[model samples]
Target: MEEVSTKPSGYKEYVAGLLAGVATVIVGHPFDTVKVKLQKHSTEVEGIKYRNGLHCTVRILATERVRRLYKGATSSFIGVAFESSLVFGIYSHTKNGPQPQVIIPSAAFGGAIISFVLCPSELVKHACNKAELLQCRMQVQGADLIVTGMFPGGSTALLRESVGNAVFFSLNTDSSDPHNLTDVGIGILTGGLGGVAFWSAVLPLDVAKTVIQTAPDKSCQRNPFQIYRRTGVRGCYAGLGPTIVRAFPANAAAIVTWKLAMKLLGIKNE
Candidate 1:
């Protein structure tokens, strides 16, 4: 069996997280696309864009090509690469550093850094996912669009990241503790559960972010509470089922891949 390293450098953590980001994007992007579509669909419409996750996925596959499901994948790749690198890098650094008790705070700080990468990427990705933009080959305002689009969701993203990261790192740390259990199985289980906890905690914020990001009209970009008022509780959680489903295997794979990559790079958990 491979031994966990007690001391992993920042570079190794970044690289491992980069690999994990790739794995996570490959597994989770399609589901995310569906989630966004569901979130952005108008609740006041006569016929819903999608009834649920399964229906949404099927409709997309049937009407659009398989590639449509991966519309924003490139942007997502870029975002996740930087975001995960910083997150895991900071997380490992703080966890292995002199003051290790501040794991939650370390993760929260990383989450804040993540917004800078995620904001622009999400803008491009969401724009690319739009039918009008796709038909126009994404001929839209460049920097101006990104700037305007990201502004509305900045606070929501911060809250989502801070809370979500705290949940993920804390749960993962408990699960991977040496005294608790043996083998990678624990990591997988804990990682999956961590994903669930993170997403569940941040789903409302995510709903608001999706609304602001994908809104066709600037007027539709409302505050989170405004969105809650308009859409109500059920609408805010429109895609919760699919998100949780995607969270499990996607995060499990990401965590396992990160550990394996770190092992290959000669970094082990202490």
Candidate 2:
């Protein structure tokens, strides 16, 4: 039997993680804008209303002279780098075990486990985005306001990935041997399926998070359940379409980047 190495190639993994992070940000950014807008739409400060997703885009373009809807893109770039690094690191480690008898399921287990780090990011990103938006509004109108609020958007993000991975991995099966095109294909498929499952599961929570973050009613005490109840099922999942569309490609990029890194580093066991 080949000796099972505890430590795989760290440098390669790190490089792969970085590359994947950059790619995921680029691929997911547009959809992310749509998702954030949809989620944050109902939020209004006093009588000042931030428009819906389309209007938000138009306003940002027309008023702010920025075609990009997102204000703090640097936050996303850095966050994605960190998040993807952790995710890919964990994934490569878990996937190195004697080819999982049930490959995708094991992969999903790995994916869900990484949610711990990602969840906090979700919370911080939404908070920061809202804060920035509020700042922009106040600055534009020259109003005096101090905005401080915390929402547990990250909690559901972690939950979403955890649950989504569980569902996808449970359904996955693998027949490919090592170092084969078939193996790569299986990996890609596994990642794509896992991404879909993960995003779908979290769609509702994502919607709620957007609403809470952008809403100026910081004094209003409402829970996630309340947000869902207010929005109804459809409202809670308003941005599902865009999310699902982006997830597949983003996940595929991650998987491919990992494989390429592994190969380039000559870290193959075979």
Candidate 3:
């Protein structure tokens, strides 16, 4: 069989990506909140905040209510929506162009764009997640809990996105040929694997970001190296379980939605 063009018009891909992003945030925000909490938990603290993902989910629900799990939802929704749009839009544009072997490069470029948005958005999301906890622990009433700093971990984010998208788009491209299964099924499987790869590659950086973002004060200036030294290898992967669990369904849905939206818009593989 001849190679099929997975290209879609830029506008179509952007719109599809936005839909995918919304679906991803709605499905994955709670798991993501828990993952951040788990990653940022310090052994130095008097007591552990959560024993595991299950424990974390239970506690957040019981004490903070379901809404707490969605702290910073608006920021994440907006950020991921744009981020996904950029990723898909760029990928579609580049793949359709005359450039040879463009998939990897397109993915890498898309990743770079994603990093810019993810840094600030992630910072806000993490701060929002811990705002109540911080307020309760610090006993500061009506305090402005926004954390601000120069963006760190852009390189790692780039690596994660480039590598993960490479895998995702490559797999997605290969799987687009419909033998018996629907496009959605192929998208789901490939997307889930891509999500797993993305998280696995970036979990360490994520842990570092969590630590820095959730630091008790501006004086708590610890880099990724410091965090590694303090927590060791295991610390870098504190919430791997929840992240992987969250990755499959959320990303699968996002990818499926993206592909389906493209189909609905009459963008066909040729």
Best by the TM-score measure? 1
Compared with the true structure, what per-residue lDDT tens digits does model 2 show for residues 49-165?
656556656655676665475555777778777767765555555664444454445455555656665654554554565677556545643433322233234455555665565
Candidate 3, pairs of clashing residues: none
Report the C-alpha lDDT of model 1 over 47-100, residue by residue, as the tens digit. Answer: 656778788889889989788889879967887777888888878776744333
lDDT of 3 by residue, 152-246 (tens): 45555566567667766655664253333675577778889878887887788778877875666555655677878889999999878877999
What is the clash count of model 3?
0
Compare the candidates by lDDT and give the number of the best one.
Answer: 1
Name the regions of candidate 2 deviating beyond 4 angstroms: 1-7, 30-75, 94-120, 127-151, 165-189, 212-222, 268-270
Q: In model 3, what lDDT does residue 138 have?
A: 45
Q: State the C-alpha lDDT per candidate.
A: 0.77, 0.60, 0.72
Error of 1 at 40 (Å): 12
Weakest ten-residue segment in model 3 by summed lDDT: 141-150
The residue pairs found clashing in candidate 1 are 4-268, 4-269, 5-268, 5-269
Using lDDT as the yardstick, the better of models 1 and 3 is 1
When 2 and 3 are scored with lDDT, the better candidate is 3
